[model samples]
Target: MRDPILEGALRRVRDEKARDRGRRGRLRAATSAALAAAVLAGGLHLGRHSLPAHRILVATTGSTRMTTTITPADGWVRLHAAVDGIDPGERCTLVVTDSHGRRYVAGGWVAARREHTDLDGAALVDPADLATISVVTVDGRTLVTTTA
Candidate 1:
């Protein structure tokens, strides 16, 4: 009861539809992957900007070197310094100077018998007005100074 020509035509149409469905499925998977990658990239960008930026300064004088990282927040600044090449057991001071010649002592500690000493200090000064950061000896000898 079926015409051979009509049956052949219907078979071709069904085969074409199956191929089209496979293509569509592949395209959908690709689009989903692209969208997920974009969302992840955007999230990383936002997270990076949400954190405070840290400014690092390093200086060396003679055999002494000082590296300082400054973070400003809420009208105050925090400083983390690593000092090297100073003699062990020497008392040292971390000094933060403003552009107006005002000095704020961040913190102080005795040098340990190690390769480097790490010090943490905070100052009640605006970060924009920071001028110089110095590591000085207890008797007023400057070990190193870095300009901010």
Candidate 2:
């Protein structure tokens, strides 16, 4: 035979255990949600601040036109050039000049006779030091030049 007092005490213990488990589960869910929110906030902050700087320059000489987008990085600058009016099969060079008169060749390509010839290049000079950008032929003829 079970004593009524002992049975009542046992019931109370079981009820308390159930309530504690519920509390723990809720706590776990809340912690997970908080962690997710923190991760999302961190990602947004990085995305907003880590965006690269951009500048666009346009230059034309006689017939050829060039538009360049410059992006500054740690110790270098990235260049995206869009050129038009160059003859097919013409070899062209992209050059960057710094304030100290140092020249850097960013890239080169052969024109394809399309409406636009787009290419990318980089120079080991800081964007702040960049003075001029030029598109030139292999024989030192400048197609176009623009201040940076």
What stretches of model 1 exceed 4 Å from their correct place?
A: 1-52
| Tens digit of per-residue lDDT, candidate 2, span 5-61 | 999999999999999999999999999999999999999998865736799999999
TM-score of 1: 0.64
Cα RMSD (Å) between model 2 and the true structure?
Answer: 4.2
Q: Which candidate is the best by TM-score?
A: 2
lDDT by residue for model 1 (15-109), tens? 99999999999999999999999999999988865536889999999989899999986577899999888888989899999999999999999
TM-score of each: 0.64, 0.65
Task: Name the weakest run of 10 consecutive residues (lDDT summed) in model 2.
Answer: 44-53
Cα deviation at 140, candidate 1, in Å, is 0.6
Best by lDDT: 2
Candidate 2, backbone clash total: 0
